[model samples]
Target: QQTPASYYFTEKKAAETRIQPRQKFSHKGTFGHALLVAGSFGKMGAAVLSGKACLRSGAGLLTMHVPACGYEIMQISLPEAMTTVDKHEKINTQLPELDAYSAVGIGPGIGKEQPTVELVEKLLDTIGVPLLIDADALNILSENRQLLDKLPAKTILTPHPKEFQRLAGDSSNEFERLEAGRQFAIRHQVIICLKGANTAVILSNGDVHFNSTGNAGMATGGTGDVLSGIITSLLAQKYPAEDAAILGVYEHGLAGDRAAARRGQSALIASDVVEYLGW
Candidate 1:
């Protein structure tokens, strides 16, 4: 079957246009503080990766909320980020003051425990700023469909194919899935960063911007967390939701392309993408 040509293209230059040079006199407070809720007992790496990427992506300050067990790991691995420990050792059950952070990114390694589910609900109720939802949070939304309407306006959701399938039901082909994603975004009044191939950014008004960066080398673990972090950082920097999704996705894929060029597709890992995120 033939696929329709995309009318919207996320050009590399356009993404670059959105990145403004920082003022030398500005303090860290000039950029926004990003709150990241991620990781579990065994998945502490996710928190580290996301936090690191957020910092590298130019967020002024980053606070990582992880399970208690990941405290030492997060502190040692990513000293640039401040760490907050959840009461639970393996999964988060508590909520934090949402007013402090300019933007919040959740999920990553978060497990789908009942307490975490409750935590997600509480977050939806409390978060007033931009939010980036991914991984387990996406899973939580897929399972608990009732929470869909509760999301903050212009919330960004990053989901791969299988994950999107769970949220919007399966489609027979990529073209069909893309259409489903468009409808899903419009129905939910949210931005969908459908990650894969040329990652598609679907807006609530039904516009689809296909990213031209990225390669097969990025098909590894932790990359999605990196993408989420980048998007969250852009949000913290005060990019509008639609612009953030489009630019972040383009830069993420561009970084992936750079990583693949240097390390080759088979050798590329999520960290490499973060390392190659050259502004």
Candidate 2:
């Protein structure tokens, strides 16, 4: 028989209660610094969205590492973030020194160039802090299957249906796909956020927690990048990997739900979700 929904599903009440209120005595340094490696020649918007969402989600500091071509755009669009320029004028060809940041989120808008692939490999081999991988970084992994074994314990990977399929292979249906995702998470010792209507946050130990928030309006582009930022912010704040994924997914969807309610589904965009982030 199929596992009971209650065993794996998460509800809004649980999410609401789990969210910790900021302490009045807390300073910016207490929240944590986040590093985001994102953007490219034509995709600087992704970096801007991710960086803005990261700050809005309570990260104390954010540094956006982008290709040279995106430097001006990032500076203009998200003035609050610090910038690190890559030598490549278009695609990311290098990773910044990681020791300074509390956590790192990568792969929003980064194209799958060979150098970019190498950067991902290097990140897997060296990054010691909590890491969250998304967008093309996940795609790079799909293409370079051998790197799977190098992933650090509890690294978070956010993959939509198509991306998950590429990494884990095809399944006959949703149920089969979920099981495939769970198995993949266990096998790799990673967490998987299988994004959809109710995104499933699958822990490494095989617990599947389906988010209770979010609306269909969130299907727009750049939303996933925003999620990567929020989760990375939580990770930087030192929430355990499982808590970060669960809380991040819940809050991301909740923001989408709020945006949808205000603007209506048709008018809701990824930026709207960012604006609606209330916590």
Candidate 3:
């Protein structure tokens, strides 16, 4: 008897085993650098979670570019991470030099002042590598839709439904929402991970993979930040964008589930997911 395809699950170990490849003699330099730009006044938790998740996902070196005010908090909280203190207390209209990093993640807890929007545009214009974009970065894109076409090919954009609607234009229903996601990916020459129930990851070539590992417990504020980290790490480790989106989304949801199992859904924090990254 044929079972419903929606009834199946992609096991956590299945993704990890399939996606984690090998090197004959790997070194610290082999894994590649990941740069994360995150944090703001009340949202420092996003920065903390993303930095930790990147390390857990095995990025060899990480530098978090945050606003000046977050410098001491970030450094004290995560000693292993290096930071760039943008003097404006928030990342303003200046674009950081991104040439060194293999992968980048941005937009977690980034507030949308006018200058921040300009900085986002500058980053999109200047960055030459794959990116995992989230949060207010997606918001900034929605505000300025033309920036979508200018994004680097192979970049990964993680947007929740509201953000997805803003970036891809409004959707009247679920089917339209997904079609909008797929079209945006192809048009931008990148990957789109619309995070929600049965999270849909659409690629530039018109492939869509719906993930089934997460639950409503992961709807917390910092969950997307952790997801941004996972995809950033995967890209830094040289996973193709599609595989990274598929596998990273799977593992991220599973990690959230693991956190929920231990802490219960009500108390399942985003940090718990990062803590269980090794489990």
For 87-185, candidate 3 gives per-residue lDDT tens digits of 787553456788889888888888888888888888887887778889899998888878877788978889999888778788789977877777677
Please give the ranking of all candidate structures by lDDT, highest first, separated by commas.
2, 1, 3
lDDT of 2 by residue, 1-279 (tens): 243222356777777666767899999888898999999888888898889889888988999999999888988988888999999999988889998899999989998999999999999999999999998999999999999999999999999999999999999999899889888888899999999998999998888998888988998999998999999999988888998999999999989988998989989888998999877
When summed lDDT is taken over every stretch of 10 residues in candidate 3, the lowest stretch is 1-10
Query: What is the model-wide C-alpha lDDT for candidate 1?
Result: 0.90
User: Model 1 over residues 1-279: C-alpha lDDT tens digits?
Assistant: 332334488776877787777999988998899999999989988888888888988899999999999999998999899989999989888888888899999999999999999999999988889999999999999999999989887999999988899999989998799889888887788999998988999887778888999999988999999999999998998989988899889888888988898879999999999998866
lDDT of each: 0.90, 0.90, 0.82
In candidate 3, stretches whose alpha carbon ends up further than 4 angstroms from where it belongs are 1-14, 22-24
Write down the TM-score for model 3: 0.91
RMSD of each: 2.4, 1.8, 3.9
